[model samples]
Target: MVSDKNSEYKFTGGNSLTGIHKLYHEVMMLNELWNGYGAYEVSYAAGKSGISFGGNQMDMHDNKKTAEKFTNILISATDNAGKHFFTQGEVKMIVGNEFVNLIQNGEVVLSMLGDNLASINAALSSVYGRARIDQLYVSEIKNGAEHIEKVIEKITNAAAKKFYDSDLGRVLLFDYHNQYDLKFDGRFLADYINGKGKENFSTKEMVVAPRDHSKYRAIC
Candidate 1:
């Protein structure tokens, strides 16, 4: 385990999710390691000084008599490494536009909901041996009621945008259709939702990859 001297560091940037995501993702990695499924390499640095290590399921087998020691090592190493990444001016986390607006259609949303849920249910049945998807879906909706309301507001705004932007989008669509003189398919309505057709109806944010784990070790 990393010593308290190494673990004691400062965080300057405020990311609503950065700390939580690191904690949760690291715990998930530990759980996978416990199940003999994953490995992690952790590195620590303070100014010009640094150290690194790694462990895997084989190490856990070697330390089964004192498994908590191994667990602490993994957790502490991850925590300290994350602290370095955040405090050394390496990663910048910016929170922007809590709510995004995009054109949406009720019918399209409903269709997407049905298609996505059906696919989810099928996969859940194969993996978990039953259909708990709808039950969990309802629970999420209840728990996230506030977020749901915000989503509704965004969707409403998007629907209004579709009406206002119809001319440009429609001209583009009409030109495409007229150029090909293609027969209408059911996809036309879905395409009409995005005007000129993008894969997903909503805009998406880009993600940045963090630095690689610098070192690793194993016991077994």
Candidate 2:
């Protein structure tokens, strides 16, 4: 029940007051005192200049109240502090390329589709040849449709990248057995489509972390 200006009053002596009636009386006095004072202000004078008080404190107070009203809206719209959102197609591309990069980097131990482990292994081996590939066989048959749709979307979007420089970017693979890899060689393919390849050739890297860290570590 404390008035806005007298908000500090509760922290002063209210801790000792036992009875509810006593607390009520104290709150009433605080409200009266706050209303009589209008608002608090301070003034400073420099040299012979006249001192001025209450210049824009009231405006600032009003602005603070206005700001509080919209605080929730502001917080909701900008709360991306720790979350990442990706489109279906983008996610597929990232997953596919990440798998390929892992295989090329020799980090993957297995790869599979549904219960078809041997087929998947053979397909990937035939596509990349003798490379170590990881297998992940999906036990749930219900996810097959969604998985296929995502793969197709990723492949369609990825196919647009195959005619530039080999070092331009990592290619996404849809049909490992069929050798369907989406290559974004450079800005050349994009530029060629937009009629700008004649001006410049794109510089890019097809391999991920191509440098040998082991060699650098030995030198160090």
Candidate 3:
């Protein structure tokens, strides 16, 4: 067991271990994109995390059985200028189908937006034109901001409420924590590394390599 004094430090190590893995994957994707197609945003809406994409996506995939295990372990190792040091309760296990629900809600929102694109665009244009006119007459440029804000809030709140009332949203918001607590095993690191050495710490079969490496050349 990790001592209380060292828990925070241990957690930091675990966090970094997972963080590097994520950065590695992200860079790999960026490199691929750079080599082939020019920069472009993916069409995936709020992938893994609906409202906050970057914050939550980092943790969602790191806790898988096939992925690196860190959170539940009693001790963690870190590379400090090529030298390794240990810290102690640094394992983190996150469990929940939050990503799945986010995708479901995101799809609903996207579909709603697509269906009402014409009306939405018209309303936005109207607001912009009104604001521009108001600017010419008023001392402050924000003279018509309140009107536009209210209109936007009304439309956005309605759409958000629809998501909140859905079955997936209700379950994700209310029931996920209570029902899937076991899914996140903070002690997973300890369990996984019982007889393992640091050299064997890498995630095993985490990514399925291409069958024909030569055939998978970057389309530069």
Best by TM-score: 3
lDDT of 2 by residue, 99-215 (tens): 331122111212212233232222222312111111111111112223323333332222232221111111112122111122334232223322333343255423222133343
Which regions of candidate 1 are displaced past 4 Å? 1-128, 141-146, 152-220
lDDT of 1 by residue, 1-220 (tens): 2222211122111112233233322332333223311122222222222221121111211223222322233222222223311221111111012201001222332233343333222222221211122232233223333332332233222543343233333333333332222233323333333233424435543222111212111110
Clashing pairs in 1: 54-216, 54-217
Write down the lDDT that model 3 would get: 0.25
Error of 1 at 67 (Å): 25
The 10 consecutive residues of candidate 2 with the worst lDDT sum are 132-141
Greater-lDDT candidate between 1 and 3? 1
lDDT of 3 by residue, 1-220 (tens): 0001211111111122233233332332232223222111112224442211111111222233211221111122223243222232111211123223222343443453353333322221232322322232122112222232332233223333344234333333222222122122222111221212223236542332223323323311
Return the top candidate by lDDT: 1
Error of 3 at 8 (Å): 44
